[model samples]
Target: MVDDTGQKQTPNTLEEPLDLNRLSLDEQIYVNMRNDREFQGRLHACDQHLNTILGDVEETVTTIEIDEETYGEMHTSTKWNTSMLFGQEDGFVLVAPSLRVG
Candidate 1:
């Protein structure tokens, strides 16, 4: 669509109902997995099964521990980046392109 000045505006993809394959096409997306792991990447390709090829991927793995003496919690997070990645559909918690992470 174009504005009054005749400049084209980016389509709001969110206006459409989202399904996995549609949302995965050429967008920045987040994939939450089992075991407290999350992946953020630009989705290049995907299928109905949710198996995907992602580029410029960042992976964050969170770990929590308790101290025996204080009974306090210790939380740790490790993050890494990769140029490209492939993911299986197994153990996927959610895949969202709209949600932003801190």
Candidate 2:
């Protein structure tokens, strides 16, 4: 199938009730954390404890600012790349490599 960018992509064969730790092995994963931080990376390892090791990772941090006069919110995001990083279970908000935000 083709993705939004019109590039052909392989479909994931994992069934429902997926085993995340197993699915992530050597695969690109998307991670959401509690502090408005998100990560996309190649999953190197993870344990049942949710401790994860990622490689060639890109990390995004989102910030929201409230406008004083208009009472509106402005959202901004910053991204950085890391060769390797570790994420602990307690920091995770969501994890699913194949699921995209729709």
Tens-place lDDT per residue, model 1, 10-102, is 654333344545755777988999989999999998876777888999999999999999999999999999999999989688888755458
Name the best candidate (by TM-score): 2
lDDT of each: 0.82, 0.85
> lDDT tens digits, residues 45-99, model 2?
9887888999999999999999999989999999999999999999999887755
lDDT assessment of candidate 1: 0.82
- TM-scores, each model vs. reference: 0.73, 0.77
Name the runs in model 2 displaced over 4 angstroms.
1-18, 99-102
- Model 1: what TM-score? 0.73
